[model samples]
Target: MRLTPDEGDLTARAFARLDARLTRDTGRPVALALSGGGDSIALLRLATEWARARGRSVLALTVDHGLNPESGGWTAFAAEAARAAGADWCGLSWDGDKPQTGLTAAARAARHGLIAQAAREAGARVVLFAQTADDIAEADLMRSEGSTLGRVREWSPSPAWPQGRGLMLLRPLLGERRAVLRDWLAGQGADWIEDPANVDPKFGRSRARQALAGAAPPAPEEARALAGGRPTMDGEAMVNVRRDIGARALAAALVCVGGGATPPRGARLQALTARLRAGENFAATLCGARIEAAGDAVRVMREAGDLGRRGTAPQVLTPGVEAVWDGRFTFRAEHPGWSVEAARGRLASLSDADRTEINRLPAATRGAWPVLIRDGALAPVLAGEGVERRALVAERLRLALDETTHEDDLISATR
Candidate 1:
């Protein structure tokens, strides 16, 4: 694990490249998730130095999962390290009833959720993670062993969106090795905490690491070309093009419209794409989305049944706080005391014009549209003449599609 002077020089160059890419993608005021581990500590130092040189700011966030008694001390140490690097620091905790089973998965989700929330509150649009080459190799091994884990890309859209509104996740250190990073830290006379979970054989990741000993690190993946603008596809034209593009684009559309966390299964998606390519006209449902093919066009929308099953009860909207209703639309009110509920059953009360506008949307998705209530009367918030709000929703949907499309394209290219 020892690094020569040349390796150290290469690591520095890699850091510089990452800094430039991050600065170009996300401007001032970046956020870093610091865990008091060697990888994250190295990232904190590198990001702080880069931000200082560019006259920008960095927000260092540490999440205390509270699973271990020593987590509090780890957070304090992380905060101190951030301060030593001349960066602003914040600590968040995952406080709630701990699950009896699947503790690791639950904690990981909580950690990401808390980090995204904190970054949004701090007005940061991008958060950096410290996952390294070693982590990627281990993840690949886990997947080969039928773990069902997904690949971690270098640039990914935040999984916890709306709560993480306008946020992107960056793993700049994915190209660097863990040993090199720790060696770099040692050379700088810096210290980091060693979490016992890393070696607690009960964890699959720990077992993977031990199994990876003496194995050559996997070759670094070439950075994928992300679309600079929003992705658009004509369903009719897509079927005539590459099957990969058609399938990937279709998956992205379904996930975006359905507001699902992950895309549908690969085999099912591919089969659907094949059917569409054969010019079949039919309707079906998958991943909370209703897919309809008519004439030469295919359309996808949120499934009404799924919405009814999972929709949240009416909640009062507070001024300056945004809420995601029905997991499809993000609602924020400038005025207070407004309650948001599904537009279902209340559409009958609207004017003919409003009703027509509501009906223009896909039949399967009309039930999930957000409606405002005040004084016990329903009001059309997103229907008819509310062009600005409609445009905002469209923009968010486009962004989501862009992210999913980018990841899909990357995976296809790599395969």
Candidate 2:
């Protein structure tokens, strides 16, 4: 259904505010994760019009989780809706056997990965999601019932690991209520799917949704606030500690420097944050990141023992295939090499300069750093042997320090 004049104007203003939030990528398309549900259907309608008005285009992506027999029908419906809305569409599928446990969280992660990969390939720096204020309420309720789901925000970097790198999620509808959107869709004569899973009591979200069926969402939590100068990264993937850093920001630094998928949570993370905030001189480890504080300055790096305990070992570098080791370094090879392994036990064989550099890092950090193989001998990575390798410090640090971690105000950056 075409938007009424008021609806069109509302969408333009809402999206225009978001578009101004980030650097525009000039000519790249914006992507929407279209699930054929009420929220996404409304989003598809609004986005197509919003994009067209600004001379931009929209790509609607649907991920077929393959859990329901009706999933195919859902995907097809999504395609048709996108077409009707004047947006291009693509369908992705989760093709493997479903795990018996943790299915919901797993499916969500898979969906995030698929959408993030597709968005990047389409040259989008941001992917639009249709989460509304109801989602925030549900999350709060679920957490109260002991769920582990992270709190949803109006905007965040995508949650999928490396796949979600370089992309941000735009939830322009976060301030909108689910019921209001559904009511508007009905008035427009637009239809959407009501997935059976939503009402299934087996799921925490479903239970929460049922409990609050008609209850107005409580005031949304204040968006996460970030303050102070950003943390610095030394050559060794160390985040130089600073006073007055937020716990969330400090958690982000630990996760990045430690090469972990997510930041540590609960009491330990809070304790660490407290220490740094006081500018105390202490050494501690949380997640895989080890901290060395000297009162005047602090350094955070990967704990090599953590890597070994986690069974990090050598692996062959496959030509043309991107390889990630310790989640800290990524390597691609177009020619022969022995393997990518830790610098421990093999530091003596490296060139003098390479050895010196490696040794300069804190002793606990050097072992987890990557060292390449040349002619079956452990060696520092050579410059011209058809290999490409980089420490992922800059990219990870940038994400951790992204100032908009808590603000959603609907402004978006161009890619």
Candidate 3:
């Protein structure tokens, strides 16, 4: 019986590609979302061998969606399989009420969020996914059927909001077929769970999978669309797209500003994108972001809302603990007894110069800016004494505008 993947085999090579991608400290464990399915089980086994040789560890996380009656059993199997494969295991569950209409999408988002949080807490900067060649074909088919399921790539930043802030996802098995992995598992005498949902007709993925009729996965070619035109961003992350930007680029910019899970719909987004390309002067709202375009320049920012409703929801800071607020900013405080909230009522207390600068921003942004607070006194966005703050929205816009963003979305073949 085979105890490890053959060194020259595709599976081994797939795991080997992780060497250059891991930029974190060598001591930190690499994370995997193990579902006990054929693909993930194969990856966990192969990765176990890969990590051991590199003096690293693997953390396998199994998320129990609780949608199936046998979910508990699946979780148990995943834990056992991970441990048997010489990897650490953790079981996470989806604990809230399920949405009746979009259970699939909601479950996926929740699963990602849970995994991202767990990985971050464990100091894992990269999350390994078992997305195989078959999964890619299936995603394409699902999209053709008008499903909004996102395009899966070999490597990309985690799509889950705030929780996925600092994590990158690596799909090493993207070049391998599901059947190849299953055959390898069989050779290794490994058993895997088959989730019944994979065959359910109600789901788009299931339908897409069944429609394949055993066709081969498409070639490992790049499918991302690269956009043109650089965007100028300011200190506030106000994006000014002067030249031309694609729908995806605009959508990404709005995602940063809106800080919402859902991007703008295709029709409305295409319409607005056309207007921007034509250099029309107009203002509009999509998702939670407000856009103002003038003379070939498009600027986006978070829309002003009823901040008092939640009042920016002050989050107590823990010493050396990093937290994300409103999905736009990441905050870290060196010492405790501090918190972060909105610049609502405290805006009136700003110095004359501070007030003048704040007024320069759109009315949509003035009151909602994040403020560091201590003993009920509001501190400026630039907090003192070991406080570290970063605007996630700005980073997102920068990535969206960078031409190399899409070009570097895949793992290097040679590496």
Local accuracy by lDDT, each model: 0.69, 0.77, 0.76
Looking at candidate 2, what is the lDDT of residue 231? 78
Over the stretch 198-299, how does candidate 1's per-residue lDDT look in tens digits? 998999999999999767677555545433223354321111122223554566567666666666645688788777777778888887777777765566
Model 2 regions lying over 4 Å from their true place: 1-9, 22-25, 218-229, 275-282, 313-323, 332-339, 380-386, 404-415
Which 10 consecutive residues of model 1 have the lowest summed lDDT?
235-244
> Against the correct fold, how does model 1 do in TM-score?
0.84
lDDT preference between candidates 2 and 3, better one: 2
lDDT, candidate 3, 1-415, per-residue tens: 5434432386547755666465323777889999999999988988888887778899999999999999999899999999998999999999988998988888999999999889978977778999988988998888787877767776666777777765677788888888878888888788999888899998888989999958988755453654755555656656666537877777877777877766675678999888877777898888677788877556887766645554456788888877877778777888877788777777877777778878888777677777777756644553647888877776555443332232133222101
> What are the models' TM-scores?
0.84, 0.87, 0.87
User: Which of candidates 1 and 2 reaches a greater lDDT?
Assistant: 2
RMSD of 2: 3.8
Order by TM-score, highest first: 2, 3, 1
